[model samples]
Target: MSAPSPAQADTPRSTGFLLLFALANAGGVIGYLPLLSILLPARIDAIAGDARLDLFTITVIAGAAAASLSNIAFGWLSDRSGGRRRWVAFGLALTAAAYAAVALATTPVAIVLAIVAFQIAINALLAPFLAIMADEIPDSQKGVAGGLLAFAAPVASAFSAMLVLSPFTDTTRLLLIPAAAALCVLPMLRTKPRLLAIQTVEKTLSPPRELAIAWGSRLLIQISGAVLSLYSFYYFQSLGTRPDLAARVAQVLTIAYVLALPIAVLSGRVSDRIGRRKPFLLAAAFTAALGLTGMAATRDFGMAALCFGLFQIGSAVFLALHSAFATQLLPNPQHRGRDLGLLNLTNTLPSLLGPLLAWTLATPQDFGAVMLVLAALAICGGLVILFIRED
Candidate 1:
């Protein structure tokens, strides 16, 4: 292992810094997701004809494989090097290049390759950045930081929708703009040397069993959410039978997430004050289950939107706290980047499972069965969390 560079050492923390950091991470994530969630499926249909679903599934499978490998590998490297800024900077630069590649892709194979590259680069960006969170944030306030981080998805989704609806219809601009936004926050990552006497000590390491239980619980809920999110545009298209209307419905669904952002942030803050994570996480799971069930039972777009909004609120709460709690559960503070990388398996695993589950259970006309499966998973996620002893 190389000696610690001056840049790898611990830096001073501030509220403003955390905010900007979260924003940058969110921007980078949104850069690809909107295209993934909104544009890619339709684009595949245009390029590949009747095999669009197969192409979408294959691409996601490949991307998932890439994400899983890259996250853990880069995380291990970051922990060993004790650095975040350089890796993030490199990731942002690589992500920009990958997005440009996506913009130029003319075939399904080309698009899939681009997507894989993007996923790898994005994971590289996220793994190191998340490690920085584990390194810097105190346990008492991690929920607050997690809440701020949770805002990234909704905000990015909403922004993506707006871009789609705008006159800038070029895929190049759509991809590049968010890439630029991601890089804009790079200055926030500047680090200073660690002071040897200062140590973060509020939270003890959680038991391995407890951490595993929490991981399982969170993984199921994340899979459920992934199923809903990845197929939302297609689901709406089936309902309306008009591409434009489906896009509009997808936009509305994303707005629900944006509206729920406050609830997510508040839930984290409240959880911090109460000093409890299990209850909020449990409620999040149950709420998502209810929403998934409601969506399955409803035919009306309005009703479905309401249901999905509920799910969004619940999911946001769960994910925000999961971030904080997962960080606390790390067995080795020195290896936090690598450990969190393992925890991130929960996130990437769903990209594989969610799509496969949807392909097996739901056709374009029969999302109800898939929704039921998702609801069941959400319920199970909540139930599993009961096994964890917080102490």
Candidate 2:
């Protein structure tokens, strides 16, 4: 894959717009931190006050579920609509509106509605944004795209940490998440990318068995590595830290993200050139399992932080290769959006369930159980790959 000409690459690869687009995606994490810090606390307070489950929890779960389902639907919609810029712009607009709604919460029910709005709107942007990356970047350089996307995590961490210290109390202004996202995206909106006539996309007939193995491997590692669902920061809070646990997590995950970015870029390019996904996938799962297992067992902040880095290493490896694998597995070019959307749900589902399972298994210093479960899930996901027929 040689580089395209400047005239050919003329689709406005402006550094500011490209970086802003990347940052827009990462900004979601900042908005999401409140789920751990504020939303859960609010619900717990409501529960304690009422001696019953609050409407807030139900609203959140329901909203999340709806949002996830719509993620697939919208992804499918984007693919069917021809990967056009207009459709993606629609998604971004929806996302901005949803985030704005989230900043307007006056009641738990309202908060739930706001989040649900955000979730649906955000995915509208996420799905199409990814598809555009697939459509635009030369396959050879997808590694850079993967790295940039992965970079979003650290950038998000940096922003989320800043939010913790911010002085705004208005839902809209409390954290500058809305403002940050707006600033990042404003440039892109003003200077849009040109679209070609919807071309028939190149797609795989069936994901190669090896790539499936890779996806399977990723599924498990993600499940295992996903411990910070509902109770994570609060769990840290219960540990009697005087400062906010959410704030601490933001700091730690930010560092982990920064470390993961360059690695993701390198791994993505290597996989593209080599054209094999299994070895990296296998290494990712194994390392992730190690990281999660370490995090589950450790009490010290530094140790936990180190484990975060290790786990992120595995995740970055898998994600960097994700596009390479996706292009390998898809049996239908037409269904790429739907298939990828469903695949993404693997991440969302774990977030939805990991915390719930942790809640049930909550006990004194026994967070190790979550890691064990995560490991098993990852291992099984890897095993599933062994059965996939290669492209």
Q: Which has the greatest lDDT?
A: 1
Q: For model 2, what is the C-alpha lDDT against the true structure?
A: 0.60
Worst 10 residues of 2 by lDDT: 1-10
- Please provide, for model 2 over 210-253, each residue's C-alpha lDDT reduced to its tens digit, 9 standing for 90 to 100: 54555555556555544554445544544446446656776776
TM-score of each: 0.92, 0.80
**Candidate 1 C-alpha error for residue 281, in Å:** 0.5
Candidate 1 stretches greater than 4 Å from native: 1-13, 191-203
Candidate 1 per-residue lDDT, tens place, 67-110, comes to: 99999999999878765767877777777777788788879889
Candidate 2, which segments miss by more than 4 Å at Cα?
A: 1-21, 27-60, 170-175, 186-204, 207-217, 363-366, 382-391
Residue pairs clashing in model 2 are: 168-174, 205-331, 207-329, 208-390, 208-391, 209-389, 209-390, 213-385, 220-378
**Model 1 worst lDDT window (10 residues):** 1-10
**Candidate 1 local distance difference test against the native:** 0.78
